[model samples]
Target: MKRREFAALGLASLALPALAADAGFDGQVEAFLEALWRLDPDAAVAAGRFEFAPQITLPGSAQRDRQRAFLKHWLAEFENRSDATLSVSQRMDRAMLIAKINSDLWQLDTLREWAWNPANYNPAGPLDLLLNTDYAPLPERLKALKPRVAALPAFYRAAQASLAPNGGVTREHTELAIQQAPGVLGVLDDIAKRAAEAGQAATFKAPLAQARAAVNGYGAHLKRLLPSARRSFRIGAALYEAKFAHDIQSARTAKATYEIALQRREEVLAGMQAQAAALWPSVIGAEAPPADRFALIGRVIAKLSERHVARERFVDEIRAQIPQLEAWVRDHDLLNQDMSKPLAVRETPEYERGVAGASIEAPGPYRPQDKTYYNVTPLDELTPEQAESSLREYNHWILQILSIHEAIPGHYTQLVHANRVPGKVKALFGNGAMIEGWAVYGERMMIESGYGASPEMTLMWGKWHLRAVTNTLLDYSVHTGGMTEADALDLLMRQAFQTEREAREKWRRVQLTSVQLTSYFSGYSEIFVLREQLKAKSGPGGFDLKAFHEKFLGYGSAPVRLIAAEMIRS
Candidate 1:
């Protein structure tokens, strides 16, 4: 039978309820999301719902209780409607919505990061979004921001009270909150300037000063709590496993994925060793190769890392490489590129910085037409030594790979496709693994297609690939296996061929996050496996790479396993 016919047969095999009488289900979905947006207005603003720009969900029990009730009621409503009640497309949407609701419920009830993670309370992002985005007239945007700014004092105060009742906050999270608290002042200052430009300074002056003081006071409060902030950052095995299931939604368990990553790490290391040996004479002069394979690979990577651009040219270099990447992907016919959707390369905002060096801030599904930002953290802020270390880590070849991952045909491209997807549910509640995995898979696809085809590029790509592999290892080991700082650093710097600066940052990142690090390897591996299986099924001549990609991404940002099942069935 044909694939679509097989998909129909497969759906028929499962006994399901009768279809809904009318379009009531669609209305329910719309109603559910509208309620969700109101309860979580900051998220709504980020998703391009400017109507919620002035709202702020205060951090306390009352708000949590309300959220809990909302989620419970919606969960029952959606659960009441069975798979047979929805159309094929609506089935996918319903499944995604249910998973999103369950994840939120688990987060609010089980994990409870809100009480322990002080970094959860920052107002910088939404405030900055309102101030910076040209979604409306400057005067109107400022007017909407007034209520949110006015609520800052109570927000921080409630944040303080939220922590006291929940035992102690995690020290790392507290430190991060302290580090990022002052950045809100920058947003407030920008608003002040913008308000003045629009001749509305007086309207904003009082709230602006009050917001700044609240931010400053919040920072000081965190500093005072630092010494006593003794809660461990590690969520341990159970929480990590649960979060992996909820956030990643992978087919395999965390332990199983970790084992696969371990095997994959050895394979990558062997490949890097081969490339390093081949380049030894040219890269390291006439000296004999080091007996230890890890040492040999590390030395070659270090030498090649010297070819990176200068500090001032770091961001400029990324911008320059984007067009080249897009051109290459176009010339090669890898995947469809949408040039009309603009991608902006900019410095990472201060508030968003402690997590990752580079990220994509795409316009939410509600505002898909707005510019998608490719944020790269600037090198100027780092000390001279720190700057050089980071530059080396990014280097020439790997820098291109980074661009492939974060921009063109990576996050920027995937997100654009996500925005165009028919339903807003998948776009809003995108699976982390699917989003991250596609980018990781993009890196491999570019390399295999010969974007940079030298042994040096091969070696660097191996090293870069190791970063994803080791990320899974580091996260799994630290959270579940009780991996020490020293062991984690050794895994990154020694085995993974990362620079000292990069290793330390990864170490810090693992503490701040959990399971998210594993998404790279888990998603990439699943996607790669699925592609190979499909290729075999389609036979060599029948398979089309570009078609496969477009079809795979066309399902929106659902979990890879779900996408796999759908694609394979079709």
Candidate 2:
């Protein structure tokens, strides 16, 4: 379904408590939340609540206007309420809801920077989420086809409308959209086949057929629109500046942020170098000569991968850890929610499409059945040399590091809690930096907690950290015109010590995505600083990792500054 519609559905789900609450003040507040939900299905779905309604799809301009109007009305209604009539908890929820709505409204106005990127354009991500969720039965999956399939034409029309006057897409973004298109079609075909076999003509068959035809038509239309897509509109530096301020809600300018991260990276590398010298005195004794950190890390990673089990066995190890991880969350009282459902680890076709090394598909608003997915993309069509390289990279220790990043107290765990957050604002305004930062932080936290006892594990974590550092530097340097792809490759190989294949793949990723590359290093630095500050303030008692994390996540995925404000207030 469309993102807006999913978001509205999420808002609606949060309102259900109002309809089910006890009478008087609490009931009235719940009633208000319920009303907001009915008004915004898109918000509702995003928050992991489902409402029974067809997805709403519209042209980009039209949707923007509609979203603005909805937020205006929603805000007004919230302001009209009297706090005297509500209980304390109800009042807090109301305040949070209003804050969230306002934040999202502001974000909507400033999110034009990403308009040209295909990552935000299409429906493949959501489609994968639906297919991966255990809660979605065959019938439910078929039912979902209506809104998703129906929305294709509008999505295409919006893409066409958003196209530049020149007849080509931005060279960097072209590959992602084109790659995702075939995958989307593949999904549509799968749904169509499933619908036909079920013999359910009304809900499933008709919509599926309509959607399949539309997708085909849309593909043809895209080719026609491709030439016009190439022209660059003058987004101007002012708009780009505004995107950092309003869209990201960040205090740091893009340049300032990049500088801070770069400085921190140099400091970290120096520290690591010192540690390497001390730990391996014979290899790189007291006053060690220049050594490639990337190569050292890569060698360690290669060894770890070899030591671990292959794919299926690796998946089993991850699955086995679920109960332990879940119990850890509960035993420590980390966050304010229950996430008992077992996450499934599977290989998906999208994995092969370069979605990421691994990812978690959180539950949608209308999906009552929630299943968290831990996905690993399998390598396809490898030459003998390539096959050996691929195997070396996917080795057991490396897989474990990946598993920690995608599952455990990482993305899956954090997302589950995030889904359960009561207000639409926190849910809808979720920041990429926070989401990704928390996952990277989780990986390090595990290692610090002694999870990285083996040499392979240490190497794997080090490799990931190097990637984060390299990604941040590349993102800024490439965009600001200070560095070329060759420079980036050299940095990755010489400084980060990545394998030739890994370095090349990362260079391509850096080209394909802009701001996203900065997320890892920026996020890690933000969290690292916050953790240090918290430790200093709390001193002996303040060093509770569980408490700090739960509180950090409770504020929703805002910029680190906002999170700091909330933490201080709490």
Candidate 3:
């Protein structure tokens, strides 16, 4: 189908074979997936459906209505199916797809991020993937990118029309969009360079220029909206609760998780204090320990934080650490490590920054063979003070922890396992808590397994673990309870031992995002509890830690609670 024709197709009009009632569950799943890919081309491309590469779904009423109809139809179809008749895998996929449908519907009808978040309109991501990934030849990728690039003007216009007026647009989001606008320009510039390589520079010149101009215009539009952007970034209570449920899918409620995080905070603090007190003489030298416990812990952590790599070596340092982590996991006989998979630690792309400093950009299940990017935002972009603060925040020990979290047996390894799982749905629609929780869990698991086995390492891990606990507190309190910046900063810098730069960015992050910060602790806590329960049930030496890790991860990024149930049953 032509890009526009496919883009314009509603669920009802979608070309699907075996639409008859007797098509069976597999047929229905196939049909639903086909329609889904056509509707959301960005997801399609991510999942390695390059045929949809040229299409861009416009962000306006027409597309929203089409998506609403698409979600409702599939949701009903999946709902009608009896779980008893389906195979175990099919049942899991069906449940996941239904949940995904409902989540998409909620996002469209209730959340309506397109109307509020101008940053949602950027076409840089998919376009960049196509241009850079070598998923296909340059000429073909550029050829496919042309029409989408040509449609940029209309896309931005629709985005402008989609924004809700009279305080719907948040200043932070608008400002974020403006900051990221250059990223779109950067993508275009890169695309131009590639097009020149392909000897198709002349062909792409006009559209690329038009696309660049449109991006610039969008930035200008957001600049105008900034003055009038009165909507608070806080989603408030009701929205926060709903979003938390949808996104986290935790067994516990958001309020319950917040309480648990509060409790976890105290436990982590106690652990950190003990570790710090033990290491104080060595780390802090002749300095006297503070009478206050927190003050003492802070002093020790601050001293440790100062022992980071140079700003220039930051990204390379993360790269070099990956092999060491992999070797450690292998030597320790931790979870099964996939040695064949490629993990490339790179500088965070321009447009993808502003949310978190470091993250993993794993390929979708369809393209499992692609390199998983460990994106570390380089320190060159920061001011001297800011750079020093970041360096301190991700000091030698914590940087190793970060490496384990983002690479090795953390996200990259988990994702590799996820991609190899039986069902693509779970890999594609992964639970954020499960993914992040496993990373948090991995950090602790590594320390427990004797990687970086020192009081200093233990103490740093405690500080790192505390960061996850505090993230939940910060996110829940800020969104639901109206946490002010001062209190939040104090909670981070003083209590969690985060550097000032890290805390400030997190404050901005909490404003720009909702419910995400809670993932690490929420997932980690559930996974930890499940592991302990199983270990206790199995008696001494019966439960294998490696077995438990492998089994839990084998569920392919399903929620920790669901995985726990499966584990218990097994």
Q: Which of the two candidates, 2 or 3, achieves a greater TM-score against the reference?
A: 3
TM-score of 1: 0.95
Every model's TM-score: 0.95, 0.76, 0.95
Lowest-sum lDDT 10-residue window in model 1: 1-10
Q: What tens digits encode model 3's per-residue C-alpha lDDT throughout 84-144?
A: 6665556667877888889999998898888899888878888888887787778888988
lDDT of 2 at 166: 52
lDDT of 2 by residue, 454-558 (tens): 544564566567677777677667656547778988887767766566677777776664566667666767888888877888778657776677667655455
Predicted structure 3, TM vs. truth: 0.95
lDDT of 1 by residue, 1-570 (tens): 000000000001111123443377788888998998888888788778999887878988999999999999999998898777665557877887888889989999999898889898888878887888899988899889889989999999998888853338888998888888657787888888988999989988898888888888989888888888877888999999999999888999999999999999889988889889999999999999999999999889999999999999999999999889989999999888778878899998887778789887777777667787888899988999999999999998999999988886778888777766655777777777887888899999999899899999888888888889889989999998889999998998888888899899989998998898999999999999999999999986999988878888877777898889877877
- Please identify model 1 stretches exceeding 4 Å from their true place: 1-22, 165-167
**Cα RMSDs, all models:** 5.5, 5.8, 5.6
Against the reference, the lDDT scores of all candidates come to 0.83, 0.58, 0.83
Output the lDDT of residue 472, model 1. Answer: 92
